[model samples]
Target: MAISSYDISSANTELARRAGYVDAQWALPAINAVELRRLQRRSNLHATLSTSLWLGLTVIAGFAVVATAWSWWSIPSVAVYAALYGGASDSRWHEMGHGTAFRSRRANDVIYYLACFMLLRGPTIWRWSHYRHHTDTIIKGHDAEIAFQRPPSVARTLWRFTHLQGGSELLLRLVRHAGGRLDDEAKELVPAHERRRVVLESRIMIGVLLIAVIATVVLRSAIPVVLIGGSTFLGGWLVVFFGITQHAGLQENVFDHRLNTRTVMMNPVFRFLYLNMNFHVEHHMFPSVPYYSLPSLHGEISSQLAPALPSTWAAYRQIIGAFRRQQVDPNYEIPLELPKIEGDARPVEIGAESWMRGPSGEVIVGLETSFGLGELRKVDIGRHSVVVGRTESGSLFACEGWCTHAKVHLGEGAVIGEEIECPKHNARFDCRTGEATRKPAKDGLTTYPVTVSKGRVSVHLVGIDSVGS
Candidate 1:
């Protein structure tokens, strides 16, 4: 009746096998390195052409509206044109905001500043807040965009604050928030220098508003002034709507990419309108890739992009349905604890050094358990643990690490077909794909790549086929 001691070597071998351990000796299909490079070049070319076209159209439309100002019908015509222009310009701004609009950094900055002026938004403020959003896409309390859903008190406060201002006040608050000052509150994401810049920019905008007001009063025509102001405010609303629709109600998962974001498939026309931003999941997976190239990238990695929202129209239906039910959950919390790593696991070096090397030369030393970028840290597990390894057929899979949902490892968790029933929460992920098959975890566990080199074994540190390739 003596309990046997845990064998570290056996455990390591098992983990390796479950992780889709590939043999270096076997000639796996080599990725078309040349084609990947060509695709990247093509992506860049497409981005440049698309951005240029949008910019040209915006300039043309702006001039056309201004030139037609003498006509009686020009006002409404201009309003319609302005709205379309705003949409197209905002899409360009989004592209430039991600630093993907142009190959050159300085060129992107110039384009961003111009687009910001056209959209009546401060470039510095938008960029800082946006950079933070990218860093913490769905992390509540950290991600500014998705952090609004919270305790009743906070939500009520925000709702009241935003509601008090019909539109002008909202614009003012947004300006103040972007400028590193949130309605007498200190800035959360804006840097000190940037905050000063925002204040200066706000003063300039105020001066512009005063001049417009004076001109309207002197001319005894307030209609045009209202149109301009309303356009700016409406532009902000559209931006907010776009942001909320993408990941507002989705479950949050700090370590799991699948639950962290949602994807929306749309027809080519709608895709053009959205600038391919509907590919939210793919964008989250590969943020460096430009928006214009997202559709193509999604096609290339279709298998990994499963469980998507099917289409933009369907996603819109879900949004509307949730709103009708008043069951929108904006702030879904993600577990912060790292998954337990057993055996001789170590930390993965994930800086420039790791990124510079090819995947074949890279070794996955640990698992990434955080939303933002950085080195992957090692986790210490106590007794029971889930071991993910490869099969004899060279297939990858997962069982249970320690189900944070259930509080037990695979030993206690029941294995049912391709899923491991968490002894604690009943949460499951297809160990093969590391995707959540069920919820209550609303998240999935960490996955590592296993490969055998000669007689020794190694885990892939660098992500394979994660980039444009």
Candidate 2:
């Protein structure tokens, strides 16, 4: 059936009401221009320094472990050191994976590859899957980051398997998934090129494993490998445990922003161990923000987000209780509906048209048919208030009708240099490149390309391919 415009509006309104929000207040926790710029600068500094410290500690710990390995008594001590090093290195690697640890893309790539090599994981595969997770968090059937679903009978069987081996079962699952023979349905989640790259990297990781095995044989001592390897295993498991605790039992509601994810405010120890991942909801809201800056970003807008989720400990307790009751009920489902916004008669542009504007007298840039929304099966067009402005150098930039990070419009944000700052969360995005310049936003703003011909400015309704392209 051909869908009518009225059906779209009615669906949107119903969705908004179910989400417990008013259309007028859809834009939230407004902030002024100056604060946004300040926050961006602070986030940049924190990300850089934190990443460096973690890397330096990892190197030092590795040397210490090797030096202590001379004595049999030091085997367990070396194990402890190896675990600490692995965990700490993984923290820095996580930041690099997000492209927030280093300003240079090449440097981030180097760190990411090295970290993945040590962890026996695939960097390209991790990036493809993680990027998708950020774009479609809590989106069931589409998001692969969520654990695989199982029927009640299968769940019971899996529980029995886990009970038999305890930690070994978890390790077996990782091996099976990373064995480079993913099923057709599982393969679709990753880009084809990335899947190939992952298979290649997995081969390289196998080489590393072989070298470790050879070393054990040469030394005529399986004890060192067992001790050191056990530590590495424990460290990797801790990282996985942190992820499980963060999202397990959280509602997977694609359209309902409030119930979709959990929020955690961590103590300093947990923050250090998990690398500030405790702020999962804030991270979800702003994926581009570096991990180091998440805690500060969360603090700035805590009041605005408090209504959606409870304290971190509350979430932890809830998950524990659920686990005890069912032993293996991984599905925490919630109904979702898109929110609504009430405003003046303003044209809203999507994807590329978002970047263009008409001549001085005409604010609208493109006709309705310009945007390629044929593939979007369900869409709603309402009065959207967008912040459109030109920089001092005459470059035009368009952001969300509201800041996805803090629900404030870009109109209230200030343009500094080449970036626009989000007042409420101190988030910032490069106007020229449309890349996020600060934490909390993993994905950038949907940017549109602008063009001018014979004094008439036109915004393209296509996606931006690059900064200038």
Candidate 3:
């Protein structure tokens, strides 16, 4: 198949669809239950400490700049201040946006909104945009956030260091959004119900900057504006410095992250600022795994992935070479060296088993005796892949197999109490009602009425509303 042209217009088109680039299922390395449980655990204390340190550093840096505003020392001070306020906020925004940084959902929201304003991104708009980013990943014309599109623009990449072209464009978009005007892509990516919130956030962000501007005017000094609204431009270099390493020079329209995403080792300070996102490949593979747990996740899956660059410099060396090649040959991609692992070469098992009919017109999923308590199984009924699981009480429950958030098979996920957590992003849904109970999974699953009789488990093929009736 011909490669996709790689633009938003190509999304869901025949070319992209024929290439298996639209809504494509991806494979995951085999992991045991115990290892998954350990990686998925969330801790409030760990998130609290990380957030606290970030906030503490910003405060210290802000005070340092204020104390020496007119001195030569202030130049370095402001750089540190801007890095904390603008650069580091990018990572904080990303982590909190995933809602994986904190055990408490409210805590994640608090930091997410703050970082959104600091980075000048509309929270609602960005949240949905990021959801799409994960779903399509590096697929051209589908992923909204593909940095350094093929035929890499050297001038534009260099301009981003000053946040001039990119930052200005974002500010202009915010201004338009503040007036309740959304661009076509924004309207398409953001749900209608969410557009209002996106507008509201835009207004709030603009209002905050207006306040800072007014403060600067009244005080007859640029200090207020410099510290608040102007930092994004001065300190945005850090964002570009770290962000470019992630999929910058990698292939697009590929289903696997190992071929398209990169992982670079960084010093402790850079990791702290970037919130361990240097492990970009691992993060993309398991977005639900918290930032603190990424190192362990890397340790588990590193062998299956292309060898990670030992340092940021090493990664940049590769990236620069790819950029040079892609400038002339757009199809050039850095080959990934993956280690051989048993059964790693097979395609993902999806829609693997067909369902049979029961005695009373019920869809027979499987023999109840074969499905153990607390075990999840995937059953294909017609075109649908349904996840059927037995609770600890031996009660059968069934929901759509694919996660509402990213379309990953739910049978591969963990079952907690009455909820099934999506393995890709940890979004959870109530098994009985099919109501989404977590972030990123705003939509719920399609549930089916399940029954066990005469040693067989079957699902009612009626609509969701008639389930369990």
Candidate 4:
């Protein structure tokens, strides 16, 4: 396959997909059942408390800015308000968008939509864009979220601190989307079925900003604007500050996130504000795990990965040094000190027509003892791959072996309760009915009937139905 030239801007080129950049092969470190369960556990109380605290602080900061207007106190007050609005919202946007932060889907949607408006992004537009980002992280000509391209520009990097370029581009795109004019890049990312929804969301957000503008005009004060949208620009500096540490001077077009992504050890306060996103490499590798569990996940896999930066200052120094060297030699890349991963095992490949078929045409997977309770296994029957899972309660189910959304083998993914999560994009499906229960996976898997008779597990090839039918 011919690899495409690196271009950070265009998404419709189709070169990345043709060259096999999209959904390219990646390595997975071996993990045991206990650690996987702990990492995948989502606590409603923890999520609610964390979200409530952030919201309460934002409300207080907004009120402080209003009360301290036209005074020296306003300077710090505005800064706080902006950090809450722009900086903290970035993390909220990310966590909530993943739907892993909150156990309740409604809660995640509520915060996700709110953060979308606050960040001046179209909800549907950004959702799909983010999906692509995870599917092709740091893959040149495919990953839309690449922060810094090759041949880094010093002046542009400095200007990003103000977020003027990013903010202006966001606003311009918002206006165009609101007017029902989708750009080529956006058209490629956002599905046609979601275009109308994007336009509607953009219009609604624009209308809200207009209301803030009207209030500012009526009251002859910038308070309403500051409270509404101006804070994003003022507070957006911290977003850039922390975001640059992620992949600024790292290698691109690589399948491994350890080389393309960075994990920085941030202060407690910064961790709180960024919602543990400082463990970015772990988050990308195991996206099924929620933000609250990222630290544990990092600890579990950190030995096989590179050592995290000691501090934000240390990360900046490295990034700056790399940027300087890149100015002279565009090929310069920061060498990562990663430990060797040991005993790494790949997924088991099943051949077509490998399993035995009974007289009734039912595929005989194995003995009842083959499937452990709450374990997922892959089986092949006459060129078809099937996923057979047993719940802790001893219920057996069979379905399509691969994730409907990404075609990734579900056998390698984690099983929580009766749901199996896709390892590639974290999309989930209910094992019993093969129903898609998560985003980035709208289509459900095809379920097959499984029966255990005489201590043998048998799967019926007939009567396969897609999820929700």
lDDT of each: 0.48, 0.50, 0.81, 0.81
Tens-digit per-residue lDDT, 407-462, candidate 1: 43432333334554442333556656657764334467766565544433344433
Task: Tell me how many clashing residue pairs each candidate has.
Answer: 15, 12, 2, 0
Q: Write the per-residue lDDT of candidate 3 for residues 238-257, one digit (tens) a residue.
A: 99999999998887877788
Question: Which 10-residue window in model 4 sums to the lowest lDDT?
Answer: 345-354
Model 1 C-alpha RMSD vs. true structure (Å) is 17.0
Go through the candidates in order and give the C-alpha RMSD of each one to the true structure: 17.0, 10.8, 4.5, 3.9
Tens digit of per-residue lDDT, candidate 2, span 402-430: 56554555554545546665533445687
Model 1 misplaced regions, further than 4 Å: 1-48, 59-79, 147-170, 174-186, 218-228, 235-237, 324-469
Q: Give the TM-score of candidate 4.
A: 0.90
**Candidate 3 residue pairs in clash (backbone atoms < 3 Å):** 7-141, 8-141
Please, what's the RMSD in Å of model 4? 3.9
How big is the positional error of residue 97 in model 1, measured in Å on the Cα after superposition? 1.4
